[model samples]
Target: MNEAWQQALSRVPELLAAHVQISVSALALAMLICLPLAIWAARSPRVAAVTLTIASLIQTIPGLALLALFYPLLLGVSALIGGGISAFGFLPALLALTLYALLPILRNAVTGLTGVDPAAQEAADGLGMTGSQKLYYVEAPLAAPTIMAGIRTAAVWTIGAATLSTTVGQPSLGDLIFAGLQTQNWTLVLAGCLFSAALAISVDLLLGLIERGIRERRRIWAWAGLAMIAAGLLVATLPLMIARDNIVVIGAKGFSEQYILARLIGSRLEEAGYAVRYRDGLGSAVVYQALSEGDVDVYVDYSGTIWTNQMQRSDNLPKAEMLEAIAQWSSHSHGVKMLGALGFENTYAFAVRPEDARAKSLRTLDDLARVSSDFNFGTDVEFLERPEWQMVRDAYPIRFKNARSFSPTFMYPALVSGEVDVISAFSSDGRIAANGLVVLADPKGAVPSYEAILLLAPARAGDQKFVAAINPLIDAITVDNMREANYMVDREGDKKTPRQAARWLNEKLRE
Candidate 1:
C-alpha cells in the first residue's frame, strides 16, 4: 500500500471505535425514551399527536445545523448554572444525535403499538388482566416485529448522522471524512465512507434478523443477532477503557494548514513523551472556547482572529502591539496563555488570475472597486461574516455583482476555473504561487495582520518541561516554509499525508 492508504487505514480502528461508541449511545438513549413514550401514546391519542409532532419537527432540522446550535446553547446554559458543562465534545454531539434518532423510533413504535390487534387486547381485558398486564402479555408480543423495524431504521440513521459530529470537536469516522475533504485525500474519504457504510449495513442486517425472528416465532435468530451486537459494543468499548495519563489534546480548524500544524504540534509533544490526541475540523470560535475550558491543551490560532473575534476589537493595531494586547487580554479574561508567534502571517490576500489583473489594470483595492460591479467574489466560508470583511467594505466602496462561499480547499479552484473572478486567498497558501495568481494590494490596510501564534491552556501554561519542548517552535517557521509544507498535502500529484508534511516541516525547523 502507498503511504496515504497505510496512514488512512491505521487510523480506522480508533475512529471506528469512536463512531460505534457515539452511535450506539445515541440509539440506546433514543430507545429508552421512545419505547416508554410509545406505550403511553398508544393509550392516548392526544399524547401520541403531541409527542410525534415534536419528534417530527426535530427531524426537519438538518443534522449539521442541529449539531452546531447545541454548542452555543450549552455554553449559555453552563454560564447560567455557574459553569460545569463542556459545550464542545461528547455531550453536545450525543444530545443532537439522540434527538436525530428519535423521530424514526418514536413514529414506528407508536404505529406498532397502536396497530396491535384490538381483539387480542379485548380478550386479555376479558380475562381480568389490567392495562399493564394486557400490554406485557398480548399487545407487546404482537407489536414486537414492528417496533424492531423502527429500531433498525433508527440504527442506520444514527450511524449515518454520527459522521457529522466531528464539527463539534467529537471524534468519529467524520474526522477522516472532514480531513480528507480539506486536503483532497480521496483515500481517507473513501475509507471513512466505506467503514461507516459497512457498519450501518451490518447493523441493519442484524436488526433485520431480529425483526424476522420476532415476526416468524424463531427465537434463535433473534438471540444470535442480539449476541453479535453485544459483542461488537464490547469490542468498541475496550480501547476507551484502557486509561493513559497526561495525554495532551490538540485542536485544529478545518483546513490543510491547521491540519499540518496540529500534526506538527502533536509530533513535538509525542517526542517529549506525551500521549497525543487531536480534535480536528473545529470552527474558529469553537476552538478558542475549547482552549479556555481546558478541553484542548494547545493549538495554533491567528493573532487577528483572537483580537477581532474574541476581544471584539475593530480598530487595527501594529502587529507587535496587537500581539501584546491579545496576550494580556487572553490571560486576564480567559486564563489562556499566548505562548508566542510562529514567525509567519497567513493574512487574507485578495487574489485574481494574472490575465484579469493585467487586462483590467487591477493593481489594488481601489482599482478593483472601479470594476466590482462586473465581478463575482468568492471566499472561504467564514470570511464573508468576519469583521475583517466588514472593515474592508467600510474602507473601500467595493461591492461585487455576486458573492459565494466555498471550503478553503475549493476556493482556489473556483477562482482558477472562472467561476469567480476574485477570491480572498490566504497569504501563505502555496497555490497562490503555483497557479501564478496576482495578489492585489490593500493601500488602506483594511485587513488586520494575521500572525500565527501558539496558545496553551491554563493547566499547561506553567508546565516547565512541556513549555521547554515546544518553545523552540516559537518564531521558527517562515511563511515560505509554511507554504511549501501546505503544498505537500494540497498539491494534486505526489501528495503527502498531513503527518508526512509535518515531519518534513519539523526537519525544516531544525535546519
Candidate 2:
C-alpha cells in the first residue's frame, strides 16, 4: 500500500470513534425516550399495544426515509433557536438514528420487564417493598439480561442505520461506503465497511459479555467488558470530537452520487493526519451558504449545479474555462478554492426507455422538444426546481404533457413501468445501462459542463501536501467507472456497497 492507504488504515480509530458517538448517544437518548414508554406500556395490555404500534410504525419506514423525516422537525426547532443549529447536519442524524434505534430497545425492554415472575411481584408486595424498591432490588436486576439483549439489537441496528446518516450529512462509515461506491474505490470503501463491521461486531461482543455478566452477576467480567468498551470509544472519538483544532470541513450534496465523492476526499484527508469534518446532504443553496459562512471548510461540488443553480450563469464554456471561472469566482468572492476537477462528470441527461426511444426517433433534446407536449417526464425532487430545466426549456424550447418528481431510487423503475415516457437521469448513474435506458443527446448544448471539482475552504488552500495528495486521486476517476461502481449497488443481485464499488475504481485507476 502507498502512504495514503497506510495512513487511511491508521485513522480507522478516528472513524470508529465517530461511529460510536452516533450509536451510543442515539442509544442513550433512545433509552431515555423509549424505556419509560416501554415501562408504562408494560403495566397494561392496552398501553403496551399502543406503545408497540407506534414503535413498529417507525420501523416500517426505510432507514434513509426515517432519517429524512426528522429534518423538517429539527429544522423547525432550529429555526426557533436560530444561530446555526442545523437540522440538516448532526442533530437530525442523531435524532432520526435514535428513533430508528427505539423499537428493538422498547420492545425488548417491555418483554423482559413484564416477563418477571408474578409470584415474585406478589412476594415483594407482601413484604412491603415499595414499587420503586421492587423495581430497583428485585425486578430490574433479574430483567437486566433481557434489557441488555434489546440493547444489543439496538446496537447492531444502530450502527447499520447510522451508516444512512451520511444521507443527512452525518459522517460515519456510510461516508466511506457511499463515496467509495461513487468513484468505485473499494480500498477506501472497504476501509469504511470493515471498520464499521468491526465496530458493530466488537460492540455486540462487548454487550454480549455484559448481558452474560448481568445474567450471571459476574462482576469481574461485567466491569472488565464495560471498561474496555468505554476506553476504546474514548480513544476512538477523541480526534473527530475535538473540533476546535484547525480542521477543514469538506461537504457533499445530499445524494448517493455526492456521498461517494465527498467520502473519498474526507476519508483521504483524515488518513493524511489532517483533521476533517463532513457536511453532507446539505441542500444546493445550503452548501454554498455554509461554505460562505465558514461553517464547513471544504467540499466536493458540481460545475453545472454551481453554474446554473448557484450562480445563475448559463453558458457552456469549455471544461477548462468553466472550472477556471468558477474557481475564480469562488476565490475572489467567497475565499473558497476549487482545487481541481475529479476526472468524472455527473451532468443531467434526458433519457427514455430503449424501446421507446428507438421506436420514436427521440435521439436528442431537440427531438424531445418537437414532441414535448406528448411525452411525460420523471425526475428527482430537486431537478424539477433547478434552473437547468428552465434553461433547457428555454433553449430547446421543450415541454411535456405531464411531469412528476420521485426519489432517484424510484425513477428508473417508473420509466421501466411506462409510468413516465422519459426522465432526467444523471450521466454517471449506473441505472442508465442497468435499466436499458437511452441517454438522448444534448445536441443544441442545453446542459452545461458539470465536471466534479474539489472545493477547499479558503484557509485550507495553504496546505501543499494536502492539495498534492488529493489532486492525483481525484483526477483519476472517470465517468464510465462511476457508472459501473453505482451499478454494483443499484443493479439487481449485485448487493455490493459504495465502498466495494470504490475499491474497483481505485484498482482500475492503478492499472
Those runs of model 2 whose alpha carbons end farther than 4 Å from true positions after fitting are: 1-11, 44-46, 241-244, 254-286, 289-293, 300-364, 368-387, 390-511
What's the C-alpha lDDT at position 352 in model 1? 94
Query: Best lDDT goes to which candidate?
Result: 1
The alpha-carbon lDDT assigned to residue 105 of candidate 2 equals: 88
Query: How would you encode candidate 1's per-residue C-alpha lDDT over 1-511 as one tens digit per residue?
Result: 8888898888888888889999999999999999999999998999999999999999999999999999999999999999999999898999999999999899988899989888887899899999888888988899999999999999999999999999999899999999999999999999999999999999999999989989999999999999988998788667777796788999999989999999999999899999999899998989999999999999999999998999999999999999999999999998999999999999999999999999999999998899999999999888898999999999999999999999877899999999999999999998999999999999998999999999999999999989988888998999999999999999999998899999999988832
Candidate 2 TM-score to native: 0.68
- Please give the CA lDDT of all the candidate structures: 0.93, 0.78
Evaluate residue 477 in candidate 2 and report its C-alpha lDDT on the 0 to 100 scale.
83
